[model samples]
Target: MLVEFTALHWIYVVFIVLIIGFMVKRWDTSLISILGIFVLAIVATGDLTAALSKVFNSFIYAITELLSTILIISLIVAMSQVMKKSGINEVMVAPFTKLIRTPTLAYWVTGILMMIISWFFWPSPAVALLGAVLLPVAIRAGLPALGVAMAMNLFGHGIALSGDFIIQGAPKLTADAAGIPVADVVSASVPLVIVMGVVTTITAFIFLRRDMKKGTLELVGTYDGEKVEEKSENLLTLGQKKFFALLIVVAFLLDVLAMSLLKLTGGDATALVGGTAVFILLLLAVVAHKKKGLEKTTSYFIEGFQFGFKVFGPVIPIAAFFYLGDSGFIKIIGEYLPSTSQGIVNDLGLGLAALVPLTKEIAVVTLAGVGAITGLDGSGFSGITLAGSIANLFGTAIGEGTATLTALGQIAAIWVGGGTLVPWALIPAAAICNVSPFELARRNLVPVVVGLVVTTIVAMFLI
Candidate 1:
């Protein structure tokens, strides 16, 4: 099957190389994306006004594909905000404090608990809880704040965020890019996520142990018997906290049950989760504030939107560029497109297939590298739409589940920019421990790199 190389195909390759180049230099991708759209549009249509319209339309199309995910994460973030204020979030992790009498226990326990809480609250709210309550305890246990940061980084950002089982925000982005169902991405990523999580967390723990043994980690020295206590003034009562936590657990259980019984996967399942978070949020608000719950909940919604849109803004332009190269282009600029009516990336992938004999191993590794490269911008979610797009491109070249490739890219993008490898994203956790974000990222480098490699290998076989 011989395919003729065209100017559009060459343009696609040049833009891709440029995108990766900009990423390597850690430049903001929004500008590159918009520039790519203009150049590609001009090459394809040669009309200035039409090319510019296509750029905005590409952004509109990408936002349409991403709106649901953005809303869900926002809703979950709002729920977490209320949960934290009400004290429901605290009750879930307070029980674990009794088990953290030793540094080793403190390190592993904090990571495990952070993973659990972040699974539900989506990390932002959980960071506050962990920092205020857990960090002091970990420090008291003689684990250097840096060690604590490493555990939280690997488990919360690397593992839980990579999997994103509860919220499904990450999977939705990858799936949208790959043009696959979110459930498929989630299902395919299970093995890879677990392997990545286990390998990275374990490897990090080994390093921490060595550092502790060598007394390389500065110890706070003495274990303080003084306890850090949460103020009960604004917090929910113990009964209210217990009841709300139980309520959330049962609601999630019902969601899982409904998913299994009704065979609701992907969007449907995600809707269920988002709707459940709203329900719980409303219930807790009313229980805590009665009629004023509505007013207070409104503020939470505002906060959630702020967080969601701030993150969403960076990714929109990036996603728009990738969308131009995928199925979304049809919606963006239909009549203006050439008669071929094929995606730019899919076309380039075909060209690659003709030009190079890339094996599955080589293709998977390349996709993984592309994913990591995208992560260099340090906002994990924004870069993944590109990963999803690239996964589709590679999936065409190599016969594998688009979900597998997409998930691999998602994991790689996240593990890097998600917080572990990115200095800025780690600020929340690092600030909590009063350690340097650069050091947090540095400590995370080896383990996360190993995890990415191992995860990519496993992803290759998931076909």
Candidate 2:
């Protein structure tokens, strides 16, 4: 497939590089991201007034995409605030403290559990369900809060989401695009996913341990590191605390059962969890506070919203810029591209695939590279069709390894954009752990890159 390259495409490519460079340097990319949106709008619409409007419209679009995640995180936090005040959170995590006695056990146990839950419920709800309960336990076990975030992120968002074995969403998308059965892609992906997961997770653990030993791990703004004032009065008695704790657990377990029985996934699954959190928050607040229940519910919500927005504020501009790379351009700047355009991101991916040589080795490297490139937009699913199409083309030319190539591309795309290396995409874990998303992204960079490299080499052999 021949894809037309336009000025709009070039402008987007340049800004993507600039944004990534800024992030690598730990510099705020909000200004550059906003500028990128304005420039893209001005060039596309050729109307200064329309361009100005797009700047604001882009932010709205970004927020809309992120609102579900924001709501779930806030609700979980609100429920947690009451749990903490009532001593329910402590009670809930007490059992885990026995199992997670050391930092090593905490990291692996939390990560493994997150990966399992994410495979079923997906990472957004998994983060919410586990973070509140396990974060405190992990921290108390001597792991830094950021370490816990990385563990959840790498396992839940990176490993489980990339493979998507149970949900099969990722494999289905790529397989359909490749004109193959989903099972073929899933079968080929198992080895690749295992290789990538084990290598990346082990590398991360080694680095985390090294940093801990050197006393160089950062703890800024984390739950363990921050100094939060505690309420002097215990709102709930031991019986009440234990009751609410058990109720919380049973409610989430029912959510799991409902998800399995009703075949709920993604947003529906997240909504179920968020709604349950709200109910728990209200019940705990009213029962604990008595006459002040109404006031306290609102207060807890306010606190939760404050935390949510603060964590998400820096992310909005960056997400806005990237959204334009996919579907947001038409919405924010009007339908200004040529009719042949497959949005800027897909067009770029196709153009890159067209340029690469079709040798087996080059095919392996190009698939991984193209997968990572498509992931730059931060919606891991958005550009995967391009990866699948490219895999089909390369597989035909090489006369083999179509399934393996497609699987490799899917894994690379999701690991990079699904929430491991991308700052905004991984914000749920960061926000829940009270760590900086950029720092989490930075910490993930080396391990993920190494894993991709090794996985790419393994793909070369498989091909």
Candidate 3:
């Protein structure tokens, strides 16, 4: 076996299956996640004390990795609370109401806007930019909070991110590893991206509409399982509301412009949006609560932080367990993985690639499977290199379609891990809409799986 396939690797694989089982059954995976970490530590180190401590250490690693996302959600929620109370959210969404009058329109409009902005700025910052503005409008138009979350997730993270046409970040990683041109990967990915995007979005929409008509889905709009209480009386006058609303719009627009001109993406772009939100929150807090401004600002932050941590509590353990599959093993546990091992996840991907025969049908299937396995770490980008390497091996043997195979792998990795099906990965959309991340993941499960299956079959012909 490659990389000395040991008990530790088997342990990790077993727990992954168990965790997935828990998630599919709608059971809490926190216990299983923590148990997995402890067992892995014990098997790796043979120290009970160390095993116990690794559990705590893994959570620290998960939170450290997740803190930026937490902060962004906290800031956005704080700003949203103030805006909602001052009634500026109403004014901000008024123009959108004209364009999105029904649930179907709300789903498509929000999804399309999310896709366009995500292509430019990427999904994290795009979620921050769009969620506060469009979520309210969508809800008012009869789309459930979960439905709005689905739209943002599928279009932004699944479509825009998988194709990554403008940023070209995804294709660059895969193409380099596969020894192909970046343009080839991008060009090849277009049809696969379209197929996945269309299938997932339409399936999600149809399910959402069906649930709504059946009255099986809850209609309440919440941000952390709590209903937003609208202010009985508007603190801002008509003119004030309009002025503040436009000011917010202009401020975010300027941020978007700055993102393009300064070439800020990912963390830098997210920081810009976060800073803008803090300022907006302060302005609204002071205006709405005047003499009580200072106290009110503190209270709003408390509210936001409370929601952030509350939402993340269940996620930390599962994220920690997944992290161990990557570089996190060295950090959270120890450097016990053999020197030749390319981390557990990557090694497993390579192992699977080694086992599969190099025919186009098996090549495409194995690439998708390998991509998905690597993506279990939840950083979709972390594993595309492995996907690309496998694509190269299969392509070399098959004597053709390297780019198409690589593109298919990239699509599968991203759609599974970038944010659609993974609970923690897609939490931004879930947090912004105030829906449960796990529930959002569940809602996304069928659509994403169907899309991946259909896209995989389509790639057979493309190859």
What C-alpha lDDT, on a 0 to 100 scale, does residue 248 get in candidate 1?
84
* Candidate 1 per-residue lDDT over residues 285-403, each given as its tens digit: 77787778889889988988898898789988888887777766667756444566457777766766777786778878977898898888888887898888888887877656677
Model 2 C-alpha lDDT per residue in residues 322-362, reported as the tens digit of each score: 76766667877888888998767667656665666457899
Q: Would you list the clashing residue pairs of candidate 1? A: none
Q: Residue 251 error for model 3, in Å?
A: 2.0
Compared to the true structure, candidate 2 yields what TM-score? 0.66
TM of each candidate vs. truth: 0.92, 0.66, 0.65
lDDT of each: 0.80, 0.80, 0.79
> Of models 2 and 3, which has the larger TM-score?
2
Give the C-alpha miss distance for residue 175 in model 1, angstroms. 1.8
Candidate that beats the other on TM-score, 1 or 3, i.e. the better one: 1
Best by TM-score: 1
Whole-structure CA lDDT of model 3: 0.79
CA RMSD per model (angstroms) = 3.3, 7.1, 7.4
- For model 1, the superposed segments whose C-alpha errors exceed 4 Å read 1-5, 220-235, 336-341
lDDT of 3 by residue, 32-79 (tens): 889999999999999999999999999898788667666766777777
